[model samples]
Target: MAAKLIEGDPQRLGDYRLAGRLGAGRRGVVYEAYDSGGRRVAVKVPHGDSELWRPLAGEVAAIRAAAPYCTARVIDADCAGARPYVVSEYVAGPSLRGAGRTLAGPDLLHLAAALATALTALHEAGIVHRDLTPDNVLLGPDGPRVVGFGPVSPTETTLTWPRLAMSAPAYTAPEAFTGREYGPAADVFAWGAVVFHAATGREAFEGSSLGTVMHRVLSVDPDLGPIPQPLRALVADALAKDPERRPTARDLLRDLVHADATVRLGAPCLAPDCLTHASPAACLPAACLAPSGGEAPRWAQEWTAERLTAEEVLGRRVCLADALLVARAPLTLDFLLAAGGAMAARLRTPCDDPGLGTVAEDAYVTLDPADRPFAPAMFLRLADGRGGPRGTRGTEERIAEAFGPLVVRAGDLARLADPALPYAWPRLAGWIEADRDARARLARDRLFWLALTTLLTLALVVALATRGGPV
Candidate 1:
C-alpha cells in the first residue's frame, strides 16, 4: 500500500526519487520511488548501524545473487557511504497475507508452484530466504513473486524489527532453535508453513507466546485437516520436522503443477526438446513397441531431419513433468524423478548429517546430479561451519566419508570424463583434503627446523673447542 512520505524518510536514494513509503519493517523502510528513466522502483534503506537486521551489505549481495530468478530484480545499491540502500523492481500488488481469502484447488496449486520456482532459484544461488511468510510473497498480476532475500554471514546473530519480536517463531525451522546447523532445508520447512497459512488463513502453529509457537513448530505436526485434497500430502511433506524428510522446492514445483495441470511449463507448442512430444503416449520410444508380424525395410521407413542439436533443445523452456520425455540418459531421468518425487519416497533410512538426515542415503540411490559435483566442498563447509569463496555451501552431501576417495585422486585428469564415474570427482576430492586446517602441520615443521638449527650450532662450537681455536 502506498502512503505519503513523512518527514523522517529520505528524499532520494541514489538516482531513485522517493515519493512515498511503500512499507516499513524492523530492519528497514521500503519507499516507492522513481528511477532515472522515471520508472517506478522500490528502494530499501536500512536503519543506521542497527542491530535489528543483517548488515545492508549482506542484503545487497544476496539480492544481486537472486536477481536472475522470479525475484524482484536488484537495480542498484549504494553502500559507498554510511546510509546503505538497495533498489529493486517494485512489484505493485498485495502480499499473500493481504490477498484476503484462503486459496484452494487451482489457486492453491499455482501458489505452491510459483513459490517453489522462486525458492528453487534462491537455493541454486545458495541464498536462503530465512523469512518466507505470507507477507513476503507478493501476489502480482505477472504471478506470485518472492521478495525480501538477505544474506546470513558467519558470526552474525539473528536480526529483527525493534518494535516487533525477535523472529517469526511459527515460520522458523526446528533446527534453528535446537542449535543445530541449517541450510536450504530450513527454507523448505518455512515454505510448508506458508502453504498451510495460505490455505487455512491461520497460523500453522498459533500461540499467544513465542515459546508456545516455537514448541509447536519443533515438536508438533500441523493439523492438515484444513488443507484440501492432493495438496494435503504436498504440504504435509513440507511441514515435516525432519528437514531431510522434506522435498526440495524443485520437487514441490513438479508435484503441484502436475497435480492440477493449471500451470504450463512455458507455452503450448514450445517443447524444450523434440523428444518431449505432446503426451506420454507420443513420447514412447520406438524401441518400446515392436512390429508384431513383419519388419519394414530401413529405407522404406519414414525418416525426417526433425532432430535438433542438444544445445537448441535445452534452450527452450519445458514443463517440469515433460523433462523426462527429452532426457537422453537414465541418470537424467533419475535426477528429474528424484527431484520431483514425493518426500516419503525420497527418505530411506535416517543418517547422521543434521542438514540432510535420511536424504543423504536416498541421494546415493538416485544420485543428485547437481550435488554430485559439490560433495567435497559440502563436506568442508559443514566441517568448517562457514561459507567460503565458492558461494554459500548447501547441505547436499551424500556422505562425509565419501570425501576420502575424492581427495586421494585429486589430480587424475583422465578420470574426469570416465562416464563410469561422476563428472567432478577429482575437484571434489581436492577441495576436501586441501581445505583442512594446516596449523598443526606448520607447527610440527617449525619445531623440527628449530631442533636442527640448535644441533648444527652445538656441533660448530664443539669443533672449535677441539681445534683449540680463539675460544
Candidate 2:
C-alpha cells in the first residue's frame, strides 16, 4: 500500500520524483517514485548522510550480480549526492505479509518454487538475503518477487504500522541466535518458514516474546502436521537446527519441480568406464544385475535425483566407495549422495602422508558438527584433476599446494559446503591442516633468517671495535 506524501518528505531525488511513501523501517523511508521516463520505481533513502550510504552502495553491486529471476531489478542509484538513495523496479502488488489469504495446492507450490528460485539465483551470485521475511516478498502479477536485499539491522522490526506482524522471528535460522554468520542455509530455513506460513496460515515457531520465539527456533521441533507430504519432508529438512543438514535452495527447487519425474540411476558396476558401456548392467553392481527378466533390487530403484539424508542413503545399502569410484567427471548428484554417505560413515580416504590424518582431524575440530558432512565432496570437487600454474597434480599435492591455502584464506567452513556448490566433507579437513603446516613452516624459516642476520651484524660491530679505529 502506498501512502500520500507527508510534509517534510522530499519531492524529488536525482532523476526520480517521489510520489508516495511505500513504507518505513530502521534504514529509512521507502518511496513510491517515478523516473524521468515515467517508469514506476521504489527509492530507498537512508536515514543518515553519506557516511551511512556504504551498505546501500554495496547492495547495488549485489543486486546487479544476481540473475533477474523472481527478484526486483536494480535500476539506478546516487550514493554520492546530498541525499543518497537506491531505485529499483517497483513491484505492483501486496507483500506476502499483507496478502490476507491462505495459500494451498498450486498457489503454495508456486510460492515455494519462486522463492527457492530467487534464493538459488542470489546464492549463485554470492549474496545471502540475510533478512528473508514475509514482508520482503512481494506477490506481483508475474510471481513472488523478492525485494529488500541489504545489510540486516539489529534493530529492524517486522511491525509496520497497520500491517500485522507475521512470523519474522520464526524465519530466522537457529545459528543466527548463536552468533554465527548467516549463510545460504539460513535463507533456505527462512524459505521453509515462509512456505510453512503460506500453507498453514501460521508461523511454524511461535511464542509470546522475542526470547520465547528464539528459544523455540533453537530447541523445539515445529509441528509439520498441516503441511502435505513431500513438501512436509522438505520443510522439515530446511528447518533442521543444524545448518549443514539443511537442503540448499537449489536442492529445494529441484525437488519441488521434479519430485515425480526424477531420473533414477542404478548403482554403477566396478568398471571405470561402466557408465559408457552398452548394457544397463554395465553400470549396475554384480548383485544388482537382475536375472533374466527379473526386476532390479528395491535399493537400486530408490536412487533418484531427489535429495536424501546421509542416513537414508546408507539405509538403502548402497556402497558409497563404489559410487565415488564410478562417478563421471564434472561430479553429478550421484557424487553428492556418495559424499554425504562418506561423511556419515567417517570413511578415511587412503593417503600416503601419515601426518595427513592428524592434520585433517585438527582442521575438522575447527568446524561445527553440522559442517563436517560436506568437507569430502568439497575437497574432491576443488582438487579433482585441476592443479598448479604449470600442469595437473596428484590429489595430495593439490590438497597441499592449492586447496589448503584457499580454505585458510576463506576462514569459513560454510563456504566450502555451500549448497549451490559441489559438496565435500573429510578431505577439506586434511587440506586445512596441510595449509596451516605450510604457513607455520614459512614463518619459522623467516624467523631463523632474521636471527642469523642479527648475529652477523653484531659480530661485525665487535670486529670493528677490536681493530681500534682506521683501516
Candidate 3:
C-alpha cells in the first residue's frame, strides 16, 4: 500500500475505534474515536519511527499546556509512546488561505478581530508560533485558532528549527535574517502580513521565488492599498521596519476588538470567523450554515464554492443536541434531557439561576439528566406570582427559595424563541451575570441525576428479566 494510504487508514489505535481520518501532514494523522466513556474524540496517532515524532513530544505537551491560549483546545495527549499523539477539541473549518475570495467587508473585519484575539492569547503564553501564515490559521466556530507548528519555538530554541523558520520572505522581521532570538515580536510581524492577505486577496509578499520575497520583505514598504482605517494602523505597526517599534499582540487586539467592557468579556461579535459554531462541542467550527436569512447551496455545489458559514446555515439558531448527546465536555445535554421528568422535591433553588426577578418556584424548571434547562419552567413562576393574591404563594415561594439558587430567574429569562438568541444575545448572558453559581452547580447536580436515571433504567431491565410471571 502507498505510505499515504497506510498512514491514513481508519482502524483501531489501542481500544479506541477509528471512524475516519480528519487531516494529516508531516506530523501525523488524526482519526475520529469513540472513547470508553462513549465520547466523540479526535485521536492523533503519531508516525512510528520518524524523527518528526521526537520533538513532537514537546509540541504536543505545549499544545495541551497552552490550551487556554487558543481555540484549538487539547483534551488529551500521549507523548510518552514511541509515537507521540495529541487529542484535542476538533474545530472544523477552512484555513484562512482556503477561506476563498468570498469574504469581504464585515466578514473580513471580524476575521481580523478574531486573529488579533488569538494572537494576543498566544503571545501572552510566551510561545511564538513561528509559522503564522494564512494556511496555519483556521476559522473555527468560536474564533480563530493557529495551527501547523512544525517550527514552533520552545521556551528556548535549539537545532531543529527549519530554514523556513529562519525567515519567511514576506513576514520575516529585519532582525530575523540577522539571526536574533525571535520572540512574540516575530508573530506580530507575521500577523500584519497575514491580515494584509485577508483584507485584500493578495499575498502581501510577492516574489518570483523564496529568495526574491525575502529580499523585498527586508527592503520594501508593505502595500496597504484600500485598507480600512480600523486595521490600517495595526497592519502598519506590525510591518514596522524596527521590531521594537511594534505593539504587543494584546494591545493590537484590544484596539481591533473595540475593547469596551461589554465587548471584551462577552463572546466577540466581530465577523463570522470569530464564530466557531453555534454548538462549540459538536459539528466543526464555522458560522451557521445558511447564515441569517441566506440561502443554502444544492448538495452538488458543496464540492465547489458553496460552503456556508455556520451562522448563515443556522441563521442565528443554537442547538445543543449534538454536544449534549455525546459526553463532549461541560456542555453535554444529558442533564437538560433529564429535566423533562426531573422532580426536585424542594427543587433546591440552590444558587444556580441568575434570572430571578421576584418570581416564584414554578417559574424555573429543573434541568434534565442531559443538563438542558427549559425556558418554560424558568418563567412559569413569574406568571404564577403575578396572578396570586400575594407577591408569591407561600409554598411556591419556599420552593422558589430552595431552588432559588438552581432556578433560572425570570429576569434572566428572555425570549428563548428569539431568532437572534444565539447570535445577538442580550448583554446579560444566561451563563454569566447571576448572583448565584447556578450554571456550575446545575452541571454538577445533573451528573448525579443522569447517573441515577441510568441506574433506574438498568434496574428496570433487570426486574423485567427476573420476573416470574409470564406475559
Best-performing candidate as measured by TM-score: 1
Estimate, for each residue in 1-471, the C-alpha lDDT of model 2 and write its tens digit: 467678888978887667668888645688877654545678888665565565456656777867776778878887767787878888877788887667765466667777877787788777778668788888775567888775333333232311212336778888777766578998999999998888877888889988788889999988988787667899999999999999998788656543311112333223434433333235655655568678865544454333344345445655543333233343344333333322212211122221222334465566655544544544544444332222222333333333342333232221221211121224443555576688799999999999999999888888988999642
Which lDDT tens digits does candidate 3 get at residues 224-245? Answer: 8667765787788988867899
Candidates 2 and 3: which is better by TM-score?
A: 2
Whole-model Cα lDDT per candidate? Answer: 0.59, 0.62, 0.50
Query: RMSD to the native, candidate 1?
Result: 22.6
Q: What is the TM-score of each predicted model, taking all chains together?
A: 0.57, 0.53, 0.48
TM-score of 1: 0.57
Q: How far off is residue 9 in model 1, in Å?
A: 1.6
lDDT for each residue of candidate 1 in 1-471, tens digit (9 for 90 to 100):
457677777776676666667777644678777654546678878655534334446656766865254468788887655566778887767788877768876567667766776787678666777768888888765667788765343333443322122557778888787765567787888888898988889999999988787789878887899787668898889888888899987777655544533133322332233334433324443543346556532312321123332233334533333434434432232243233322112112222221111223344445457556565554455335442223332423233333323211222111211111211233333454565446567878899999999999999999999999965
Q: List ranges where model 2 is wrong by over 4 Å.
A: 55-59, 151-167, 260-471
Models sorted by TM-score, best on top = 1, 2, 3
Considering every candidate listed, which one attains the maximal lDDT?
2
Prediction 2 global C-alpha lDDT: 0.62
